[model samples]
Target chain A: MKDITEKPMQQWISKDNKAEKALKRVKQNTTARIGIGRSGARYKTDAFLRFWADQSAASDAVFTEVTPETIVNLGLFEIKTKCRSKFEMITRPDWGRIIEKDQQQILKEKCVKDPDVQIYFGDGLSSPSISANAEDMLQVLKLGLEHEGLSVGTPFFVRYCRVNTARTIGPLLNAKVVCVLIGERPGMQTDESMSAYIAYKPHPQMLESEYTVVSNISRHGIAPVEAAAHIVELILKISKAKKSGISL
Target chain B: MNNSEQAFISAGIDIGTTTTQVIFSKIRIKDTSGFGFIPKISITDKKIIYRSRIHLTPLTHENEIDALAVKELILNEYAKAGIAPSDIESGAVIITGESAEKRNAKAVTAAISEIAGNFVVAAAGGKLESVLAGKGSGAMTLSKKTGKRVANLDIGGGTTNICLFNNGKVEEAICVDIGGRLIRIDSDKISYSSAKIKECIKNLGLNIKEGQNIYNNNIVSDLETIASSMTSYLTYCIDPEMSLPKEWKDSPNTRLSNRPDIITISGGVADCIEKITSDSFAYGDIGILLGRKIKESTLTNTSFYQKSDETVNATVIGAGNFSFEISGSTIDYRNSTFPLKNVQIIDIEIDNTASTIKRKIEQFCSEYQNSTFALAAEGIKCPTFKQIEETAKLISSVFNFPEYQNKPVIIIIKEDMAKAFGQALRRKLDNNRQVICIDGIDCGIGDYIDIAKPVASGQAVPVVVKTLIF
Candidate 1:
């Protein structure tokens, strides 16, 4: 089914078009669809099918769940937000942001406290992103921070998660910084995209402006390993600036 | 919180066969990225604030460039423009035309660049000059904007540099020894004539030499013929359909493989093309005569011909505004300083096997001893994390041979994978080696790269890739 959308964008332009060379050159810089020829005032069959495939992929990404093996392999025990299922997490966004009191206690007891940086993975909208990118990104990120002579706290996974979970985790664990590597809402160009929402000394009262974001982390975008390296640098900056987002 | 803007002063100095010129420009870089996105820093504008008066190039009796006089000229221009050397940041110092062949050309350029700016890189060689002139003459911008093939002929005093740009990218560039000042007439005598132009004169059944009187010996028609010959040589270099004479087939020209849709002419000789002079020897050279011939030639009548706004200042303007390029937004660097210069690029193909890659690196290591060179390649496309790790492992084998163990290992990838690759490679090398891996920079073998300080809030670095090819 991906045959339609899987072809390189540079080669997707119609062969007979005289502007194929120019179109191919422009395609190298962007991911948006362009120069897809029309047929009788409608998208060509291939273009239409590619669009449909991308749409379906986005929906599939939202509904699916990360496999148990992925969680166990990452060497992290699982915790859940207040929401129990995907439907509740989508309908009640507030509930999706909170960790239960018992789980918070467990997080405090099990996780390292007073660390310079705390990293966590969240399958927000796309479960596939965590299973795909978390291990590699976390490896690079931990090594990068450790190389900078900063202490990195334990990593964990939170199911049915949202971005605001970092606000709670940072204060509960007495961490200086909290960075959530979470799955992003899928777009037509890619479904595997993820984002890193980083904040300094986060708490329930922190404003939205306090969170510094580095988004579009995936193989199709900024490769996870690369994004992780950048995130490591950002964490170091936050420690010096003593702030993130607009202030930093 | 909001978009950030950074502006810096840049200086460009061009020492040519007939003239020496300098220009100061204000280059502004802007962060165009919106919230929730990575910083996308780009050079937003380049404004030429001051242009120096073109001066005659000082030459020693030995035909070498008078380095002190040239340095003094540049320093005077800087003072006149009210710019301190410390105010300038990034630019290029280029030696063009036949002056680049002088015995002291390299030393002169180095001295000028050192006094010009902290980050100014001294650059020469015909290929970089051709591209710079094309950029400065506005032909390259037009091609990029219109998506048309544009070719520029920068006809200076002792050499004509030809570069063809296809939709804003350099296709090919060549420099030919066809210019106006190759034969200079002083009042009633031919003061100087190069050996090559003398051979050209002999081909026309004329005996011309240095220190010969030519005031009444039909010099006008002979000079016209010579100017027309030079014009023909330029056309032969750029136009695919224009065949050279039998003897000129093996001449000093690197012709464009594909014909351009538009053509532009610039440089000192180009300054004379727009106007005709009653006195042909006004500049004590055939520059005006050559311009008159080009104006009246069939080459100008072609529908593809376009007049360039910048004539004498094209290469200098290009040096000021176009030498630096931003690297990919996502890159990796550690324990490195700004402005690493003259690092040779060793382009290698990463084959499927690691041993084959090791052998290639071994060859490069032996070939480039006592020098710093980066390993560059068009890396894997949309590589998985595993693939990136494997490729990094393959490249880390360079450390096995002691040539790359302690020194800063620089890797340039054409693909957008340097961040991931650098991270993985750093891990393989025990997280302590100074690894600088960058991407979205396109450079090849026989080219040298210079890296400037981090810009766009440290998202990327500025790089100057100087290519030298015949």
Candidate 2:
């Protein structure tokens, strides 16, 4: 077979020049408006510290950074963050969901053997919304569950995570339920909001019926605290009903 | 029409990573004794009454499995045929490549079963790839004339499976978990940043800004780059082990026979065959060739089978054919036991809101005049373990329903949260009722609930439910 250069190849090679010009225009326009916040420039540095402070002050649940060395228990909570971009969310669901395989191993090493529930926060397509709303929601959820005399789990943060990853980790930690608070794909009206998706016996092959969802559960739509109250109620109902999402 | 007048209708459902296919067929029966009896009279022609196709995005998020996509596809296909959903007879669902790998494969299957209001069988685990390879080869043979045994390779969106056949019998098969869409392209090495990729797309004049605007917008240009990178990786990975005759080395791109005999490419990535072959030495026809062979083998085999005469809708056609096969049969042995004197199969449909479980029980009792000896309700979703207990309570109360007073109810609830819900139900039942939990993939409750004799069944036992604590 002769190695003929097809039309798709031509398009690929020519994309570089086109991308450069377009990128320059976008940078100029965005810089003029959003001004690239300090957190944007130093995402892993100062942002981490601020996130830690907020997380620590918001809840008494043991908090840990999702690093390679961090250990995860069955009922532990984890979250992922990413920039407010849909392309990244659509193209990179795996990145937003599961922890890096090696990092998952580290979690196994440092965390408890098994837990009752595992909660994760992911930036589905809106990092800012997840970071802002997730903390308050978590705090309220903890208070409600604890008040109901249900044991609370450890909580952590994930960078660029998706909803399924929480389910994947839930089974690994022996958790009966896994909740993920993530930024929903932003619409024109709002870019700073998040949602919570809770699943029972989450694994790679869970069905929508096995999950319970509380969408628009953020400060901008449903207040984080209020959302937390609903989540607590839903969780209780789910435990009693033994179902979630569409099945309910 | 006489009482003996009958019609054969079948449906094939293919759940791929990027899209789902549904096909329908109607065959006339001159006389009807029964399905297996092969009517005493014969008809000369079988016509395709309806055909429909749709492209869909894979369920990547946990919350995305609302069954709306499947529902829309099924309903639209029925509408296209100008028939109601209940009018459809039998159907088969083939979960190939990515859909089979989803975390909620069982739940998705159960949901579809409830909506379809019929028995739905999912080809999963090792069976998916094997059946796919077998069926794919059968599809290819419809288009080509080949005497030699060949291999069929299906390059889908997330994975690739290769099957070798000799004289229409599957000899060996292998599935590789790498696909075209999933090929990671590191832009940093290509002189472009993530920001640049988005900019280039915007420059294409799509007006797509940040966030949710990304979906439904064409990113064909960006996809081209990703395709190029993917081709490079695939070529590097499969080249070494690819068993190709040396004769085809000079014109390897066109020598489909020596390379794979017949490659039938299905799934979302197959749509980008042109891109995959460009800037690389591989050929796109390799996939098609494989598809042809698979199709041919299945048709030629000596077994109960139905083959498609058209191109590009094999999965749907297959599903439709299977649906007809089931409808024509006497009883659904897969979903219910035989000798229907003592047993009954009760299917329940629940909504996606609160109090659905309670409502399902109400609906069940209002519909059935007598207490069912065995109850199996499909499609229940509860978020927490607490909900599972409530659902079990509702199932237990079914015995108290006026029609079911004092009747022992062996209740089977099919929900996505089978493991969690099962645990919660077991705790609530705790010696009060006989509660058994069967994993959807492991055992079909309809097949086991009314077993005449008690034998050890390989079912997942109910374990105590636990939560994740940090």
Candidate 3:
């Protein structure tokens, strides 16, 4: 890690930005990344470097791995999709969705059947997100659901998991509401952001609109713990309505 | 598309030095997040459903507020609006200016709120009045919209509340004892003069006093001079570089660090800014004359002058509409009992070690011994789970105090980490006590926070923070 200046973007004003003080205050409440000064017609060196670095980091996140130790640390058993490796997972999207017969047996034997809610983690696009947020998010979501007296199924890890894997997992485990916390495709703003895909009574024939999604869960965004609490509340809503996503 | 929205009946009552006013508003809250996203609740709409006529604040004695009479007045407003006391869900009853100094000021405010309805806040102070008037008058919006510095002078009977806004944010709210009705007149004579006005008369060698004939040459001319000086003091407050009169030197609360691009006027005197008649003593007070002075002063002539959207009902309207805010949706709380009023806050730097943070919390609890306060902190941009666990341990340690065991432990932070921090805190408490951890509220020491019952399908709580400083 480099010791770099992480000044609140609002305070990074150029010497002659004229609106320096106003820009600083505007930056505090301002959501957009504006006021980046320029040299001639091009971005200033700092702005160019930052933009370049963030984009590179986003692309690089796709190739990373969620370490085995992290899975052990979180007390989650690991399972894999039909896709053999990261290369195959990215190239064959359909293969990444369906769990194999062997994995289905593992899920049936290891995971509780007919649970009110089933929550699991997957390293979909940005493995760093799972490594960064999985522990805290799981801790809050698990405790919050159990506190509400809802029976939650065994939590586990899915390698090369696509979001639609919930369609297969939900039917196999008899989970009324299936939730998968997966890494979102990295953006310039954050590579450590995750999304939670939840579905009620998911099946192989289910439509994409049947799943509810909460995206941008990270330290710089909604925060994993906050997102987890929100997920718990949303799960309750889905349970009461007997539906999720657009239908509910 | 499926949409859900909840509307609340709000009431705002202001008892000031000269007049009392009440306003009712319908505030609607809705979850703005799209179907798949997490809930983001906000006050979607606020409309003034009813605006009560300005009534002379009932005073039992010159030095005492008539609490019973005030209660009757609010009840009368409720009847006139065809609303019941039980209908009001949010809003505030604020006592402002010289009226707040009355012997029974606190009792009068309390009595008035009791009749208005539950959750109608009873607060009295000039600074709070200053902020409210600015927001209500639309001066704050003007600055925010134009991205320029704006200041509002709510020139009431006994005080002028000056609120400075920079890019819509309050820079500072300064209240001064310069207003229209500091000296009252009736039947061609000076019927009353406040202590501050008497000092001004003596300082300027005007020779004005109670019972002085208003028709006399010196009395009428001297009063005009006093009004002229009062308007200049307001300008001096805005731009300290101006020639400040000798009279205000003792009251150093006049100087401002930043100059405003525009000055908007509110309160009763705002209605009389343009001349209509020659009679100055028509209201049996110096209000009309002072308004005339403000209209004639350089304050009106400069580019820095703008008329506010409201005139007489600024404070009440502010108390009604702009007082309440919705907490962030992703907060953490369980076993909740809400509508908690007057919860104070203690702000500490987040970078400080947990032990150091605990010291600040202990000091605040000791200082504000009678009240339960929230531990408010600026949060780390992104904290590791280990960091959250460590901090939660320090936060839960505050429960060691015997009194805090049963009461809800509240923690408010500026970051969006309340859910994680709150979960960790619950683990530390073993779910034995109620814990309220909400984020996205920025507050500091001495601020009184009011938390409403959860709304938007229990995803968030409606909140109002009052700086009730006299």
* Best-performing candidate as measured by DockQ: 3
Candidate 1, DockQ score (0 to 1): 0.45
lDDT tens digits, residue span A37-116, model 3: 88889988887776777677787788777889989988999999999988898999999898999998898889889999
lDDT of 2 by residue, B392-423 (tens): 45654544456444444444444333333333
Of the candidates numbered 1 and 2, which has the greater lDDT value? Answer: 1
Which portions of model 3 show Cα errors greater than 4 Å?
A: A1-55, A63-77, A85-87, A102-117, A147-154, A174-176, A237-242, B252-254, B346-372, B400-403, B430-432, B468-470
In order of appearance, the predictions have TM-scores of 0.91, 0.32, 0.90
Q: How good is the docking of model 3, as DockQ? A: 0.47
The lDDT values for all models are 0.84, 0.45, 0.84
Name the regions of candidate 2 deviating beyond 4 angstroms.
Answer: A1-248, B1-6, B27-48, B58-64, B129-147, B183-271, B274-312, B322-470
In the range B377-422, model 3's lDDT, one tens digit per residue, is 8786667666777788777776655656765788888777787788
lDDT of candidate 1 over B1-470, digit per residue (tens) = 33778887888889999999999999888877777765667888999999999899999853799999999998999999999988877889989878998888989987887788778889888889999999999998989877899999999999988888988888888888988899888776889987778878877777666787776677777878888888887777777888885435447656788989998999998878887677878998889999988988866778888999798999999899998788887788877887788888877775647667566666766887667778888887667667776778887876645755766789998887787678778777856677899898888878898888887667788888888543
After superposing candidate 1, which stretches have Cα over 4 Å from the reference?
Answer: A8-11, A14-18, A25-34, A37-46, A101-114, B1-3, B247-250, B349-369, B381-383, B387-406, B419-435, B456-459, B468-470
**Candidate number that wins on DockQ, 1 or 3:** 3
A1-248 per-residue lDDT for model 2 (tens digits):
53222221112222224454334434433312121134335634433443444344332111212333232322334433332334564566555565666667655765554555566666556655654565556655665566455665566656556677765577667776678776666543345567778877677877756666666644335445445655666677676776666665
Q: Where does the lowest 10-residue lDDT sum fall in candidate 3 chain B?
A: B398-407
Better candidate number, 2 or 3, judged by TM-score: 3
TM-score of chain B of 2: 0.44
Write down the TM-score for model 1: 0.91
